[model samples]
Target: MADTWTAIDFETANQDRGSACAVGLVRVVDGRPVERHSTLIRPPDPVRHFSHHNVAVHGITAADVAHAPAWDAVWRRILDFADGGALVAHNAPFDMGVVRRACAHTGLGHPAIDYACTLALSRRTWRALADHRLPTVCAHIGHRVTRHHRADADAEAAARIMIAAMSEHGTTSLAELSRAAGLRLGRLDAVTAPTPVAAPSPVGPAADRFDHWRRAAETPMPQACPDADPSGPLFGRTVCLSGDLAAMDKPEAWRRVAEAGGHPARNVTRTTDVLVVGSHAGVGKTAKHRRAETYRERGQRIDIITEAELLSRLGMTGA
Candidate 1:
């Protein structure tokens, strides 16, 4: 609760974090909303396409933002409106990620700001609630968000939620509210576009060791479990594995697939029906992953999913 702060919400055109198609902001002064601002943005070239899922969520189509200002232009206005004040958002990480990633793509300097998450605050203050989603929290505190996905309405709702949380905790400032709720105010440090770096080639013994490790990581195909549940999601599906799964190794993953009545293959062949890709951030796609995509492009009905999705389908999420 610095005398002034901005509450923000961003709608992305696609899954990419930098694809900010619209933004809503509400500025609060002395615990009261003083200004409301919103704009539709044309996402940068690299991630400008609107996905059907995203459109369904926010109801903002490509036609809606065809003539809108680009991210850099809107970002400047956002900074001007904030006037160096802290930011508050329902989920600060997502909105702030949009800021950082969009800035990186455009080579614009990232904003250095302190921020608070009304969502986190609500979770801590109203721990008894079944869920701490924005709409749920707002409804709990009697703040009606008539337009759920609209940027302006969401920003306003977040602002009001923060105000209510402050009152609930009997705290006059952000610091006080954070301490009372046993949470910490998050910060966004100043950042700029990163320089590309080429990976160094391993030499001599290191290269040999790397090759050995790579070969050792590739697990042999497991035989399908004859007694596995036939009604399972993976039943009768030919599943392939790729990348490093968080919970288990490749052998465990293949075994689980077999346990679910799936035929686990060592590679993505013509018969492969599903490719379970694991978490491999900041790395190039694995050979199996690329093969699956190629087959899909050629009209193969291949399902590409993540490790979490695989576990969920197998009814072993926490396993």
Candidate 2:
């Protein structure tokens, strides 16, 4: 078990994993972060357009990195920062995909570096949790994550999460922890390695019924709201909704958004200015949610709030 590794996170400009716009790297030695690096890079042309949803997620914009280096120019620095140590990330596949695809797209050779996922580790470490999302796992382990989408902050959080897991399992090295969890640490170099997928746990009929209900609750239907206030607080804003709204149906919700002078959008895109995520929104992995998250990662000013919060902004108490 090596005590040193580099934990990394990448924020993409769009759905293409190779379209990385920003990266955060944290170097941990002896289970402590000793160095860190973060930077923004322009995605390749022809696919360089950043989606509104992704911009809302990370807050990065084309203008911000207009003069910044592109991936080809930036990859060397990332390699130097890793210094040949193993790499780690919350979701290793996404980040590694960015690295691999970016290299492939740019005609650059992939660097041979081993990587591990704290996400997979978290599942084994905190099996009782309802889900193993980064924020959820971070909160479960009492790690402070001030910024969720920023590559730097996310990388640091991932490092802390892994370190905490190591401590809990009495494993001094990532290799040992991977062995204990019956998981494999991923690698990238001569050949791409597949990320280990955790096997599904068996659930009884009652569990199946609950899951059905849960899935239904997550897939909210879009509603059309009319007679919006053109001069309202949400005026000029493009709003999208996800998850189940207990207070109102989709039509009523859309109506309220329109009434508030906002454009109600059925899909999340680069143009969306706000996303109202309702409770039980099983949309953490949805394409729409991911797009919104990408926008948030770039430091774009997209308001992502709960349904109640959106209603409060619209000066309403309920449907």
Candidate 3:
């Protein structure tokens, strides 16, 4: 853990000590990655004794882990991962279990680390995003992960995504992410509970909050796009936005992607995952994408998103 979020990807073996298996770590600080590491470990316990299907998912077999150190041997170094800063994993409950259980099994000294789930962050960032899976989210944001589901690769991808999501969401605090994302906070289960606030001395009739929100809700949303769902055809891929969009302003449109749990690209290249084109998406640019064959040659996808579509996704509808 560093000044920024540290994402951990751990591959388990048959639902056991797979606790300290191969892990990917990405340390983000000052909105950039200062360090990254990927390594495989042999936990002291036979927790990661692999089964056929598990081997298929991560391509790690019992033979592969036969010589690696057990959890007891690796506990100290693993603890160091959470030493400097906050940790992040896709669904932290599952990952945190590996950490906690490993600690118990090995009697390792645990660090006072704070960890958050990127999965929860994505949900709170955008309600209608198709899926929170790392690969899918990466595609929707137009980021390519060389290895899929492998602990280290997945963790690094999550770190990039966490950064992009925060930028897209205009959010700074983990508390805000927990509130919007699926990360449960203040349960007093995982961590200690906070003290209760002092009671108010006296109170009168409350202000009409319902009336105020009702008035605001009644106001028409801006009509930037026609109503269309289109099944999006973006369900299981990474997507990115490049350049000045013709359909909407950069900030607003990028915000829409994050709300959808996607990424925004300032430029399009051969590696560009998806280019959401707008009105100003003119001939030269189109030709360049074609000439470079960014989509065809590189297998990059191009999705034409109309202005109306963008607005609709934002829940804006002005009469």
Candidate 4:
């Protein structure tokens, strides 16, 4: 098994990936966590606020981080702790997004780091589970997690899960385990140049185009029927879809959201509960996406999920 790896988890103040209010980090050496660090951070906003929904999930409020250090003050220490070792997280994208966006917002250069996801590894390690959420996977592997959203506990749990997977697969290194699982390690670096934006293409079929809602008068609306299960995965949530989803058409995607008891929104706002970004979202720097990021920066709760994750939540396969 890999002798050293850093496991990280971030608890955001809102839907914006940059609104990271707390971080939990665990450094594992010889397949065991030897160092653990967790801290509350005052988000980058001048007038930082904490949403009730976010507070409910993590029990962290503005008052809790009023005296805490800002991300600029804390990021160096985090980098020093990682010390160039391979990084790991339950949902690698979300935590890595926090690092990248917070750096961008504060005008700091991102550190070059390679990271892996336990969530992806879990799918390969344990294929029998219906869902591979952090809590569910942690429980399956006999790791006790007392606090679901707490950064420290979650990070520690992720470390243990990685250790378990490595042992079960008889892998001697992170690269070996990643290869065995058919996962590509992700990387982040400071941007040295701007990317050119491609010209927009003609809108596709009405069912496939995300902007079809704009011409609703000409198209029949999908009936707004609530899901039968009040406690469905997305119950009482307002989900907004962004980018081009490769797996399904827009109408079918919206129907799935409603079927899961979530209201599908065309735009992202303070009221939007979730933002499902598709694979073809293309860097996610669009106007609506940026607006949603700003809402999160202001301390409004919004859950930004991947399209594959949304499908998993809805118990559907992309195929």
Q: Could you estimate the TM-score for every candidate?
A: 0.63, 0.60, 0.54, 0.64
lDDT (tens digit, per residue) of candidate 3 on 1-319: 2246577877766434324567777777755777777766675353444444346668876677778767664555555654556777765545665666556545554546677766555655655765556666677777898888688788887887777776776656555555445444311034223232111111112425354335334433322111112132332223444334333334434534443344444455555455554543345555434443445654545554545444443332210
Q: Write the per-residue lDDT of candidate 2 for residues 1-319, one digit (tens) a residue.
A: 4478999999877555667899999999888899999989898663476766468778998898898799878888888888888889875755886787777666677657888877667766787875556777788989877888899999998999989988998888888888887676776666344333221111222335455345434544533223222323476688988765654445446655654457788788888899888755453466667789898898767887877677555543322
Query: Pick by lDDT: which candidate is best?
Result: 1
lDDT tens per residue, model 4, 1-319: 3467899998877545567899999998877789989899998673255555467678998899999999988898898998888889876756776787777667677657888878767877888887877778888989988988899998998898999998989886788887887766767765534232221112323333444444332333344344223434576788888775655445546755664457877778778989887655365466767777899999999888887888777643321
Candidate closer to the true structure by TM-score (higher is better), 1 or 3: 1
The residue-level lDDT of candidate 1 at 96 comes to: 81
Candidate 4: the clashing residue pairs are 16-296
Q: List where candidate 1 sits over 4 angstroms from the true fold.
A: 194-319
Q: Candidates' lDDT values, in order?
A: 0.76, 0.72, 0.54, 0.73
Q: For model 1, what is the error of residue 202's alpha carbon versus the real structure, in angstroms, after optimal superposition?
A: 34
Candidate 4's TM-score reads 0.64
Off by over 4 Å in 4: 192-319
Candidate 3: which stretches are off by over 4 Å? 17-19, 46-48, 172-319
